[model samples]
Target chain A: MKRNNDNIKYDSKVISIRNLKKAFDDFEVLKGVDVDLYQGENLVVLGRSGTGKSVLIKIISGLLRADEGTVNVLGQEITNITIKNLDRLRLKIGFSFQNSALYDSMTVKENLEFPLRRHVKNLSTKEVNQNIEMILEAVGLSQAINQMPSELSGGQRKRIGIARTLILKPEIMLYDEPTAGLDPITCIDINNLINEVQERFHTSAIIITHDLTCAKATGDRVVMLLDGRFKYEGTFEDVFKQTDDEMVQRFHDYNFIE
Target chain B: MKEKTKSKFFLSKKIDKVFIKLNDIWLFVFRFFKEVFVPPYEFKEIVNQCFELGVRSLPLISLTGFIIGIVFTNQSRPSLESFGATSWLPALMSIAIIRAMAPLVTALIASGRVASKIGAEIGSMKVSEQIEALEVSAINPFKYLVVSRIVATTLMVPALTLYTALVALLGAFVNVYQFEGTSFTSFFVQVFEAITFLDVFSSVIKSFIFGFTIGVVGCYKGYTSSRGTEGVGKAANTSVVTAMFLIFIEELLSLQIINALRIVD
Candidate 1:
């Protein structure tokens, strides 16, 4: 566990998840998980499937409650607050899901405009439309604005999801398996886009992934989750430089297979 | 010894099941308020949901209500004639329609049609991680799905009940005029005179509770529903059954409560 008491200077640390514990009928998924996210940095949480990586991020976003824990984001304690306050806190953090999670009933443009129209206050219709177009262009999907999510390819849908997250201009972004189902080239493109977004907006990000390639490329710092606890925590280079750990060695060896 | 162990195991398992169900109920009640008053209502998806859930359900509800009115009147007429109370048919049928039949029948239709639709839609959304996606997007799922549905049901079910009552009277009138020289104006006078505010109030209040129950049960089942298409089917089935049962119980209870309160007053 890393202590942040001495290093606390910035008022906006993006997110702090402390002692999160979640369970489903005695399954006990997350066990006392603690993490801190800072501004303008990409932190990738790498783990096997069903290892509580996504659960950690979900707790921070207030999607799922920590059975017993405190989640502080942008200086607000989310666990004890009312839902209205939670929503207010969430406006500062945007999220892109694994499957794109685009509204099947809506066109890509409508999906992009959903949060904007809901949360953004006092924006005229013209302004909302303009913002939509701006975000669509940023994600390089202005041409596919009218197309339904079903009509788009996997990569295009992913890009549209990214566009929807970015439209709110959030200070913090959470990505759950952003590059999971895409091709290698598309994965690289998404990683580059994430980096570009970080530089442009100075936004902090928490990326949940099992793909080491994605973790190394997108992560400024990386943490490895195993058996409901973080087994490794450091920069990408620090994690890759080791050979003693069996899982890391295996992951490294598998990357060389093709 | 084996018998004792077996009984103990069964008892503990039953207790565990009760505990879990109670937990789910409590969580949903907590989430109900949490989502309703929460900011950022997810207006776009909710509009889409209302169109899909409320507007699309109108056709089925109207069709069912119309059929129920026609058939129920046609069936009850011959039986009334046997008892020499054929002329009492107008008042009798009106009392029936205005008190219990209209609301209960409409609710059954809603349970089968609207409740199942809401349950299946939300269930599949849950299975596919769409609900989780909404939460991650900072959108409250309960407000987005449940409140919009409750509001829609609140508005539409009363309108549907009124439609059922009207159609039922029309069907009874048609049945009545087909045989004897029973005047339409006379039938209207008898039926309208027989209806007190108590009858009308009870039926309307019952339908409102039925609608609210359907919305709450359907949303609860679907939201807590597990993964896969099987889970979706289970949610839809359970929601319809739960809503139907609750509506019946509410009708019985509300009638008794109304009568008791009237007596006291």
Candidate 2:
């Protein structure tokens, strides 16, 4: 492990996975992978497209099940958990999808209210409105409360999506490609938002991305997934330090854009 | 012999895939039934979907139903004249519209219009990861998305059919009054006297079946749709096609059952 950062928080593992195996029929996406997410730390999982970065987070969130290993998330084994139990566990996890995944039919306020309405069922209308208002302000989109998803730009949509996730005040956040197809400045803003979310929400996170800049800006520790396993684990520089490996050098070539 | 075996194997594989998909759809429906009766009934969503699938569809239903009445009345008017029974026009047109045409036309339109809408809406939601977002939020996406629409369709289709029946009858009456100058009261009296209770009941029942088919097939296609634009397109297309096909099948089966019931009654 590379401890390049001066301040590295090492709390007890919020997510613990060991020998995780997942396959789609004949194609094995996650072949015996192991990792851990510490409390209040940002762990970046770097991989090219189809390297199962999304699969890993999906397993952690109990959205997808592992075929042949243990995925213990929030102190519960997710693979064999009941639906009701999994749902209870999911309340503690907030997943920010790559596409933002805001309900196109709903306005920003409705999108944010959906989770709170479900989980925090006892909140009065006034309280619900307050929560939505607070979340929108927190994401710096207070003016976008009445806006439909179609009216918003990609970055705005992403912010609303994050706000929606954060409304529940989850203990763990899972960001899947927070800045995949954005301009560099927007990417930086999203990266800053990730850091802000961790700091402000007091939540651990696993950010799955292929962007090296994002890895540097947000990741307290970086893990490079190659061919369904973590090939590099450490700081951003440490991941690319061993240039002798042809695959790592190639991945570095792709992500380290000028 | 090897080539023959390989071909047979491929066919078997295809059949197995279809069966697997069918099984999954059945399980999805069963799960929907299980979840629908559980607590926190999602009353608001159900009402929202009812408004979407029911009340919002009235104008289209009225237009199609009116046209069906006009076309059927105009085409069949001369035939009754050929039989020297022009007085039977109101009775025959009313019976046809109330029993067969209204249910079929309304269902076909519902299958074409509403099923595709549902499939595309849910398909887009599925592909865009909106459904999973709901799941992550601990919300029952099936209950919110599927059950609400199904219940709305099941209730509203029959209601729409009745509305169609009225509009269609008004259309037929216009044709009758123009050609023969029959009074409105007499025409309605003849219409009511000609049709039995079983006919109206059967038409409502068939409409209900059509509604259920539209809801189930549309939701299944959408919820199980693959990712991407192509998948969404396929889901919408298959939703309309499958619902229409099932509607026709149900129409035949229902007519047969109703005919048997007519004999008993």
| Candidates' chain A TM-scores | 0.91, 0.95
RMSD of 2: 3.8
- Candidate 1 structure, TM-score to reference: 0.84
Docking quality level of the chain pair in candidate 2: medium
TM-score, A chain, model 2 = 0.95
Off by over 4 Å in 1: A1-38, A65-72, A75-85, A227-238, A256-258, B1-11, B19-23, B26-55, B82-85, B181-183, B255-265
Off by over 4 Å in 2: A1-11, B1-11
* B1-265 per-residue lDDT for model 2 (tens digits): 0111232444579787898778898898898789878986988887888888889889999998888777888899888889899899889998999889988988888888889999999999999999999888877789889998888888889989999999999888888888889999999999999998888999999999888889998998998888699999999999999999999999999989999998888
Count clashing residue pairs per candidate.
Answer: 0, 0
| lDDT of each residue in B1-265, candidate 1, tens digit only | 0111232454579787898798897788677766666655655555665676566766776676567656777788789879888888788889888787888888888889889988988898898777876776667677887778866776667767877888778777877777655898998998999888888887788788888888888888998899688999999999999999988898889989988966876
Fraction of true interface contacts that also occur in model 1: 0.39
